[model samples]
Target: MATEEVNKPPSLPPYPEMIFAAIAGLNESNGSNKSAISKYIESSYGDLPAGHATLLAHHLNKLKESGELVMVKNNYMRPNPNSPPRRGRGRPPKPKIPLPAGAVVSPARPRGRPPKPKDPATVAAAAEVGPVPPRPRGRPPKMARPAGAGPVKTGSGRPRGRPPKNKTPFAVVGFD
Candidate 1:
């Protein structure tokens, strides 16, 4: 019975529970970083496996992803239940206001610019004066250039802004 007891392996707590214990026991106001947490665990548990470091990293990532742990500035700590959930990228949605019973909600206006209202007097005048012809939909056909006209002269095709500096010797003014 004594030999059997001597040969038995030591029991270890779950990685998550060990992590929580480390954070709590270390009592860091900001939080404990990965190195600190790992050190604490190693010192607390004497019989950790050879791959303990990799295992710890995997569990830490899992905890952070699942919201079990909050990481800030590379340090890890438990999330505060009292704190509001973290906001997403953009501005938060506005809270909806409840309408009272029997309240009438107006329908949304049509999207584009509203048609211009006709003047009441013009409308009545038009009715008595017979219908006017509707204007053509697109720009009127461009007037034909007179037979004598040709393309107007525009100074060489260069853009019509400030001229670029001239490199020619003629452009240089001599004070002498």
Candidate 2:
């Protein structure tokens, strides 16, 4: 069982480790430039799949944000030794700075379809930003009757029933 577990392949690639290794392996002077890191990864392992570059970039960017790596110009670099090491990940502390009187901090939007703003003040403020364009109403204005092509005879594909011949009106439920 132990050997089987060890032999089993990972369902997903270890992207974080790969990205970190690629960045760390860079020469101090190179500053872990993105292209260099990507090339290194390809050479060491295999080509990344289509649309994967963005995901890989996100990982690298997170490292830079967390102070695990430093960015200089277009390249990322090792953090300075003098600065204290970054803390472990968890909820970040809230801002302690106080807002001036009359400041309004908008609440965080919930995930998925956002609710419309109902507050009159918020509505007025939004209106000031730009003129609200009129919405399209009813059926869309169709193309000009195809330049004398004549109106399309509308109705189902069924043929019209034969007309009654007798002068006396027969019971009729429908019309063509």
Winner by lDDT:
1
lDDT of 2 by residue, 1-176 (tens): 99999976545467778877877776757587888888888787765667667877888888888787777888887777998777657987987998999999999878898777599988889888987788888988867665788867867866688766869768978977
lDDT of 1 at 9: 76
Q: Whole-model lDDT, candidate 2? A: 0.78
- TM-score each candidate: 0.48, 0.39
Per-residue lDDT of 139 in model 2: 86
- Note each model's CA RMSD in angstroms: 11.3, 22.3
Cα lDDT of model 1 by residue, 36-117, tens digit:
9999999999789899999999999999988889999999999999998776679889999999999999999999999999
Name the top TM-score candidate.
1
